[model samples]
Target: MEEAAAWLAALDAGSATREEFEAWRAVDSRRAVAFAQVADAFEQIERLRTVHDPLPEPRRLGPVRLNRRNLLRGGVVAGGIAIAGGFAMQAAAREHAETGVGERRTVVLEDGTRVSLNTDTRISWRIKGETRSLWLDQGEIALNVRALAGPPLRLSANGMRFDLEPGAFNARREPETVALLVLKGTASAENRAVRVGALAQAIGRDISVHPAEAVAIDRARSWQNGQLVFEGESLDFVVAEFNRYLDDKLVVADPRLSRIRLGGRFTNTDPTELLKALDASFGIRAKRGESGAIMLSAS
Candidate 1:
């Protein structure tokens, strides 16, 4: 699944070649199935966006255009039959749960495991025989894994595997790393065990486990309540975090504004309170740009 996501990202970024993708996909039949599932999920997201947001007017900058042919190099369409066959084989067993921007949801699985999904998250799972497998495609989730007479609950995110004992844990998939916070019991990755109050960050094949600070755990816990807590974080960092739940992103227009440090607890779904606080406390002004983003600058 991670390899499929990487291929999709590379294709979206115009960094993948048809030859390379085909070679990778040909290695195993399951690879085609995983790629198809990821592609289908991406298409679903695009469809949802189209339904919620109207199409913008087309802009012409120059004659150069990156069409599908230029981007995909005829790979996706050529492999459609194999992908479709693969999808049909696994469609019945796999179940998916997802949330939109600024949305949260909690679900109970068949095995009595409870999962709380954060904003803009996607996850899929399947219970086959004794193994209960879950894949976090993106975003964050908190799991209260139920103890059953089995091997263990298996979870995969960002190419890392975690065998979690029946317990609670929060997992977030970041751009470069997968953060796992063990709240109860233990989680094993790469033959190492992470206990409660411990945080594990996985980058590629390497997993680093360390004790989590009190503030860090508190910040993680706050998100489930639709709140964000910061402690002396820079303006740029705060803005970036807020943009996760915002459609019209907040931008620091002035260079000096990015360096301002502040700490507060604010609602993650809306930036109005935070904006007002910034105005009253720091003499900062917020204005909407032509692109619809909120721009911040010194008053």
Candidate 2:
């Protein structure tokens, strides 16, 4: 799965030459299957990147719950997969919103619920008789839900459902994890009943509620204001966060340096300046790779 995912990433970045891809594809029959799965996932993601009409909700439940296990096997999404089951509710209207690399958008629902989407985020929402519903397929969002004299609003991410209250909060969904941080009001997970001031992390088959003491509210919410403030965060995690904002991704060549801690605030919209800051502060070397990926090494 790692090999497949690496191949997909390389292809997506235009780094994999035709000969190299053909050589890898011929190595094993299973490689073809893996590649097909990764390719299919990429196709799905690409479709989301472009503008599209909202998918008519099937007579069944709301948007299908994306099964995390099926999607994050070996940290790579599998092929020929299907979305998991969803609820049996109906909404009168459906709307889709998405942002590309280095893009952020603020959307106001009909009920005055404000949602500020972070970079590379995708979400869909709708309103039924007395219910407000939202499905976050990918990326992060800061939600400021409005008080309503109606049913509780529902926010679904990767098969886990969150009942939202009239308040402010943030939610981020990744390949292997879904995190929720409440800035105000309260939210309850489908079954876990996670606490406040914590980021609920959902992994395969389990949801762990961890205190978000390490996260500064101002820093965490700074992304909405086009900034990134990290306090003593690992290099690997920091790179991942920055990758969401740029077409060229950062790859740490040295696994040993992946966990090296660093702290600072950087503009979320600028990757070049961030790289310069990284090199100056940590003596890290940043260079462009053949695949157009930025390679980071300990200098």
Compared with the true structure, all predictions reach lDDT values of 0.77, 0.71
lDDT tens digits, residues 206-225, model 1?
77999998877887789999
Judged by whole-model lDDT over C-alpha atoms, candidate 2 comes out at 0.71
Best by TM-score: 1
TM-score of each: 0.75, 0.67
Candidate 1 global TM-score: 0.75
- Model 1: which residue pairs collide? none
User: Counting only residues 3 or more apart in sequence or on different chains, how many pairs clash (N, Cα, C under 3 Å) in candidate 2?
Assistant: 3
